[model samples]
Target chain A: MDRFMSLDRRALLAGLAATGVAAGAAALAPRALARTEPGTVLARAIPSSGELVPAVGLGTWITFNVGEDAEARDACVEVVQAFFEGGGRMIDSSPMYGSSQAVIGHALGRLGAAAPFSADKVWISSGSRGPAQIEESRRLWGVSRFDLLQVHNLLSWEEHLETLFAMKAEGRLRYVGITTSEGRRHAEFERIMRAQPLDFVQVTYNPVDREVEERILPLARERGMGVIVNRPFQQGALLRRIGRRPLPPWAAEIGCQSWAQLSLKFILGHETVTCAIPATTSVAHVRENLAAARGALPDAVMRRRIADLFGTL
Target chain B: MSEWWTYALSDFLLFSPRTYYRLFALHNAALWPAHLLALALGLAGVWMLVRPASWHGRALAAGLAAHWLWVAWTFLLVRYATINWGAGYIAAGFVAEAVLLLVLGALGNRIPPATGPGWTGQGGTDMGWPRALGIGLVLFALLLQPLAGPLAGRALAEAELFGMAPDPTVTATLGVLVAAKRIRWEMLAIPLLWCAISGATLWAMEAPDAVLMPAVGVLSLSAALARSFGGRRGTAAG
Candidate 1:
């Protein structure tokens, strides 16, 4: 990622410098300055309660399930610290992610800050296991309360949702939600949004994976539901696809400096998208991720232009 | 999606290739000394296969049993399961395979020498290239499998040597079985199944040297079936 950043800086400077005009360098100066400053990330209000969280969060999937190895654990500690220090508030994890929940606990234990908003999941097929699994997740996170608890991928949604609601009512969870991003599950996810009362909905939405753009986003808006976007980089495939390609010039117009920020900013541009949690083990990528939050978001018109440009790429 | 398509194998994959193999590399690093001892024992078993005797059979079984136990603890239970939950079951299978090998070793002279179309058996001999290839494959599993990791660009400390990593450990065991003349069909069961399972997993992960595992499975199973059902001494005991 340092390698990518060096090449990105060179391209930005060269593109501006090649113009042989002070105006070109002056134009990019503010956005470049904004990139270094903290608390610049865009924040959105959760429709259900008007609580604002940075539109950028950290996800713990495979990147954080590093078991008990001290070296791997230390690497994760660095990433968590980087994300938190970058003004990141939401740190999402789950028990189903093997040791990710535990690794989060390990990282947080090392940090000892007012840790990021704990967003966890209860992912089990049977209703009977929800309590134990959720409890285990809580223990793994070292938190008595989760800011948000989601039914992962909507596995046995009703049973888990009922448990989440009961927990929320009891003050164990500040909010309850359901998650689905697989295109095949969207139909059912849509039905759940209309039928159930939710504070947040975790969904997969990105430049290439715009399947949720049509119905899911609208339903979430119509229902006053907050959206937490996952897989913003399509599990790192997006960055790999955009490898070494210069950032689209217009990305600078939106305070974006890297493809990571561009991909994240594109998602945050949507009014319904309260946040997009892009997971990364590299602290450099974490800095790149939080930097996406600071800049001006593309409006609906610019979003389309961004989408069209992304399509061409 | 259909109601049944809730979760597929692809959904479970959360880590990247670097993270996945790095786990193996770390597993190898933490258990540095074990690799030397497991490899020496595995090579000894390979050597004993050439000089067939009841004692060699017993020693080979005990050696493989030891390797299986170590792999289950260090590779599967201790390391691999951290990323992939399916590894717990794989660990159990390794333990079961170890027990089966111990049972085979305890059977004494009943364990037969290497036999097939090209090798000596109870009532017949039909030495062929299959026997030669089987020996070569087994030797490859023990001696050459360790190099797969380094060759794929990982460091030497991260190399997945036999007796330390499950893939090479199981593959080498299957190879040794293929090179053997007479062993219970039950003895071949778990390792072959594991080869298929591990192969499918590595393929899904897009791991380096993934194809070799299932290749060993297919080649060994074909040889076992040919020597057993396609022989004059098919029903005869050692």
Candidate 2:
């Protein structure tokens, strides 16, 4: 944690070199400025309660499954600490991702009252098993209740959603949603989005995979459900696919330093997106991701431009 | 069920290669000096394979049984299960294999020693291609398999040794089974399954040496089948 603090301080001192430069300055010192000036991450309103959450939250899919290795576990702690310091609140995990929920619990235990917006999922096939799984997730997270709980991959979703809705009604859970990824079962997902009174919907959305842009995003907007974008980097495949390719010059206009930030900015640029959860293992990456939420999201033209350029790449 | 077909092998791999190797590193560190004992047992297995005496074969089976149980507990159940949710199932398989090996060893003298075409058996005669392949495999598992980590850009500390880690242990067991005059289907079942499982796992991690494990399984199983059928043909000719 202290290592990241010094990194921020070092970036801050670098940013202080160029003063009073208004327009092009953000592009010049995106990292330095974002590091020095904390609490500037763009916040979006959850359509259900109008409560704001940072547009860029941490996702723990493959990143946080370190599993009992003390050093790797501590490295995860640094990532969560860096996220909290970068003004990130929501941290998402699933019961399907082995040991991730426990690692998050360990981090939360270490960070004691870091005020995270905890989100987890109940992924069992049995409806009767749903409550026990969710309770186990809660125990693993060491939280009294999760801010949001989703039906993972819509496995036995109908039964899980009922339990989630009941939990929400009982004040045991704050919000209820359903998740699907890799664009699997979108028709079923959209059907549930229309049928259920869901508060949130987590789905895969990146520059390359834009299936949701046509129907799901528009429907989420129509249904007034907050949208959480998962797989913002396609589980790092997108970034690896764009390997070492220079960022487009227009990226600076949106305060994007790396392809990761550009990919995140593209997702968050959409009006319907409440948050984009990009999972990472590095604290520098967490800080860089949080920086994407800070300033100047791409407009409609810029977003199409990004999508077009990504297709070419 | 049709939806399940859409899923790829990589989707189920929840941990990274780095984390996977580090698990071994940590496991090896915690179980210091036991690696030497595993190596000694591996050498003993090789001796039994080459000698082909009834007592030696029985002792080898008991040694392998003990190794399977130890690996099932220490590595699979305690260590690998941390990252892989399916590891407990694999551990159960290992335990079952251990029990079968124990049964085979306990009923030693009742089962006749091999006298077929390639049978080195109590005669202590020259082992044909099957036993030769078996000895090569056991030696590779004992001496060469550990270096795979270092060769594949992993730390030497993370080296998976025979009898200690599942991959090399299974590989060595297949070697011993293939070397024997007769292949017991019950004893061969679990190690072969583990080979397929381990191969898929390493493939998902994009490890370059992923093919090596399953290749060992296929090669050994093929040799065993050839020897078994060839022995029947030799008997008919005689």
Candidate 3:
């Protein structure tokens, strides 16, 4: 009876948050219902476990790796807070990014008891480092277990993959996967995907760098694997190139108020993409990215249209 | 993975040009006017190169040692380390280089670099052009490299200085050191390597001046090597 009462109260609060988000969306685009409950409106389904997660997540590569600076740390705190308040869950990070894991934990600690979909990576060289690194990641995130554990950049993957699979079986991690960036080592990445039973795979794909679209995306779709797209803004190069160009008249037709939303929505329009992790230092940019996850996703035609428009820019 | 391989410098960086320049800006703003003083010292060292005395080489080395130390503390330690973890160790390299230069400078007339260019069987002819080039380089470090910010769309307030910033500091030092009468091949190792590393980093970021960096490093290295040893002296004017 007590559990039931708590669930009801949580639902009520989520409904309020959803209403607020809906009202905010009204200012920007046509009203389309998001495929989620009140707060988790733009969530996507993970193919392996059928677990739902938000379609837009945060990446901590360079944006969140500001070391030991108080002003930067406080600003990151605000970004993380705004991310959660807008229904984001998957906060992806790696130890390669110095100080990002700690900052995420620092931010997570501030919002006690919120169920965050913790997805982290095992980023260490060979030897008995696999387990120790995983333990360190857990300690850093202040969580007992990670929802997803990927082998970062396929470094020592044969050894690390075995360790990750063992941990998943042992219930230390909920999912096991491998990742690579910029389509580098793609042949090897493809071979691993074919051989290993990975639950998730991260690849760098954006409107500009579409090499992954040829094989990797289709392969993930065929293999029932969840895909995470990194470098959605090409590490801010694409946006910087676009500068402050006016958004197209047709952008409102697809519910994109900002170019960030347009770019992310193009990535999400594909059926295989589970999420896109676009890292940003600005809290306002975080809101813009989260909004991309909601409302409308384009069909194949609309997706190509986005490509053409982006190309001309 | 089928085969394990060592990663290159480009592998680690998913770099952005905007962010890279902003790093320079942050560094420049943090350590203002130190660049100016480094420039002044650098000019004096260059002038010494053009007209050398018995103790001028030691004075030049002392000046370079101080500039290298400043770069180690300000740019690498405080600024670059914030973004790149490898910078901390790289700072140690700069410190080591400074100590070596300082010790070499203090040891008095023993160092080979002390005997100004024409001494010890070195063919110092064609020095007119190289000397002119050397003067330009030293002044560039002091006067022009900071001003180069505007060309790159960077503001004057965020201008990186000669003594404080690594590139101009190293470039300017090479400008003078390479012109020193009897060149020292051993002393150029660390600075050249730093130039190469920083060049590769900028290349990975696709910065506009990426080509110029290693070009200068290689050219300076070649010029220094050519004049350092194994050449017969010419009767041409110094």
Candidate 4:
């Protein structure tokens, strides 16, 4: 009994020492648990709830479409790693994008505990059963409950939103939302927002495409729903429009190094925006994009400068 | 000419008129240097291959291969960029051009000599009207396939090219026929086989609305022709 007690005591002491060392290391290097490096700017509360999220997020529409191959897998891993390293948290993907959700799932699996996940959309417009579509989306993402489950492009929003709402009630989803880009179904989107109690609304709002600013953003704010900006670069069209024009002198003040940053900053500056998801295939581009979330945002004057800069185009 | 040159330069330098201006202004200036370095390396490779007793044929083949690879990379980049932005037609054009260049380069080396078709000299004149027309038609069909749909007005426009929408089967079939006539029968089989494999793979992958039957038929015909031709040539030699 004495020998057994001694051995147990020794084992307990060793376990405690090891745990102490691990805790010390974790305290010293917080990045060990971090999905992404915290940017210079702090996260904002999602007005309705005190949920803090990094202002910059990654979109996997184009970049994350790794077509079920090893090379694509590696590229996605690099992109996800860069996003996580650069303080990006929210990763938006969809079924509309080819194998994007699968790639994101693969990256997350590779990332293990370090993966920073957000939400994705279910784009089942073929009149399939809504519950089946949701189940399939859950399976594709490999998550029992999604951070947010959105109806892509407001397609069968009524049916999907009902399912999402029920899931939310059952604590399967933290938030329920609707998404519509390209300003295609604004009237329907507005009607849904007015009628439903949604936590988020995804829309396209960039400097070049200011159509969303007129109604969608204000409506989102009024409804107390977090607005996720999509196509903040107008799918590279805004960058093309601002072609070859040197960044105005004042752009440096807002930490706008590339037009990508400038464009993202413009979207981030909006008080209504919860996060802007810009798609990029390059790791360098991901780093550049994450930088937009850092430092002081452009005030009203700088916003004018941005507007004027692109106005010349 | 000046306008055309300016547009071409802008397209090449800027990647596109839209992207050129943004990167130009944002001080994201690494692309120019990278492009210059790539161009220098490409030129140096070409020069080295062209040097005396440098295995000109192998060098040419290597250069063509390298060019096609580069084009494919750029094609993917452009397609990825443009597709997300709702500029599908522009993306299709870029990809089609890449495919056209690859096909032309592959076939260019295999054309029989112009000296009465049997002399077996180096080859035909570098550029010929028939070959140019065939290439143009193929490129046009490739580019236009993305614009049409199965539900579109034209029957030929409903064919699949490179697994994009609006199946370009009829036009692609016609193009293959033209290619077979213009190029050697033996050489034509390779492209047919490639198309068949690619189409079959796409079909098997459950890609929507892709027709692989024509491509399979073409490959079978090519294989049959190859076998029969080989038998005849062997008997004659004996």
Best by DockQ: 2
Complex DockQ per candidate: 0.42, 0.64, 0.24, 0.03
For residue A81, give model 3's deviation from the true position in Å: 2.1
Estimate the TM-score for candidate 2.
0.90
Model 3 TM-score (B-chain only): 0.82
Proportion of the native interface contacts kept in model 2:
0.74
TM-score for each model = 0.87, 0.90, 0.79, 0.55
lDDT tens digits by residue: candidate 3, B36-110 = 676677777766766656677678777788888888987788777766778889999988878777786545432
Question: What Cα-based lDDT does every candidate model obtain?
Answer: 0.75, 0.81, 0.73, 0.55
Compared with the true structure, what per-residue lDDT tens digits does model 1 show for residues B1-238?
3455666655657665666777777887777787778778877766676655546767777777888998898888887888778889988988998888887654553344464453343453433444556667768877787788788667776677788887777777766665556545787889888887777666767677778778888888887777666643543344
Interface RMSD of 1: 2.5
Off by over 4 Å in 3: A1-40, A109-115, A135-145, A207-215, A218-223, A240-248, A307-313, B1-47, B99-126, B155-157, B203-215, B225-238
Query: Each prediction's Cα RMSD?
Result: 8.7, 7.3, 6.8, 17.4
Top lDDT prediction, candidate number: 2
The better-scoring model by TM-score among 1 and 4 is: 1
Q: What is the per-residue lDDT of model 4 for residues A1-313, given as tens digits with 9 covering 90 to 100?
A: 0000111223323423464443333234332121222344334335444355666788876556544345557877888888877656788987667567777878888887654546888777644476676677678767666788788888777777878788889887778889977677788889999999998899988777778888888888788888888988866768877788788777888778988898888877776777889988789999998777776677667776786677677
Query: Please, what are the lDDT tens digits per residue for candidate 2 over residues A1-313?
Result: 0000112323333333332321133323333222323336666556665555677899999889989999999999999999988878899999988899999999999999777889899999999999999999999999989999999999999899999999999999989999999889999999999999999999999999999999999999899899999999888888888899999898998788999998888988887888899998999999999988877778889999999988888
Model 2 regions lying over 4 Å from their true place: A1-39, B108-121, B124-127, B234-238
lDDT of 4 by residue, B1-238 (tens): 1224323211221122222122122211322334344334434433332231213323333343443344334433433332222224433443454344345533343321112123233332222333333333344444544343333332332233332221232233233333322333443443354455435433443344335434444544543354345323321110
RMSD of 1: 8.7
Candidate chain B TM-scores, in order:
0.85, 0.90, 0.82, 0.30
User: TM-score: which is higher, 3 or 4?
Assistant: 3
Report the lDDT tens digits of candidate 3 across residue range A214-267: 999889878878899998997787998999999998888778898888999899
